[model samples]
Target: MISAPPPRPRDTTFGRSTPDAMQLSPDIPTVELTSLLGGGREAVILHNGERYRLRVTANDKLILTK
Candidate 1:
């Protein structure tokens, strides 16, 4: 008796399993703290009617506080 051929691999070309879904946005918008704070070390960001403070710590790391 003849056996059946091996099954083909699943096609993921048109699915989110492709690498395209794992890539970052090509044109990501960014804000420079120096410009936003005008030579200061902190700035407030208003989003969706909420206030969030973005600051640089003494050790030079960023911190976001609500």
Candidate 2:
């Protein structure tokens, strides 16, 4: 006896030509360090009852610590 071929995957694109239509949100929320710190070198962020320190070093690099 001959067996049938496996079925092809369904198309979830909904007839859209470009894949960009499947994207959720086009924009992301962002915060600049200088703005968050208010021109200061360091700032503290409280998340989920934990404290995180964000700082800018003399070498112009960002550092985050718990």
Candidate 3:
């Protein structure tokens, strides 16, 4: 029987962060997801008086919706 090929590993680097090339700007504040979500899968963000829902999908990707 024919079988499917093995799945390739997901690239979490987002095509930017690399060893020796990784540099974060001090101007922008960094916040960890753990601290932001407080160990939850979702968090609500308030921006410009609008409410947005930010949640992690089943595939472990993030999604934001109004």
Against the true structure, whose TM-score is highest?
3
Per-residue lDDT tens digits for candidate 2, residues 8-39, read 99878754656565665658655666788998
Alpha carbon deviation, residue 37, candidate 3 (Å): 0.8
lDDT of 1 by residue, 1-66 (tens): 999999999855543644565456769765656888889999999999999998989987788999
Clashing pairs in 2: none
TM-score of predicted model 3?
A: 0.62
State each model's CA lDDT, in order: 0.79, 0.82, 0.82
Task: Find the 10 residues in a row with the least total lDDT in model 2.
Answer: 15-24
Q: Please identify which of the two predictions, 1 or 3, would achieve the higher lDDT against the true structure.
A: 3
Which of the predicted structures, 2 or 3, would earn the higher TM-score when compared with the native? 3
CA displacement after TM-score superposition, residue 10 of candidate 1 (Å): 31
Cα deviation in Å at residue 62, candidate 2? Answer: 0.4
Q: Which segments of candidate 1 are over 4 A away from where they belong? A: 1-24
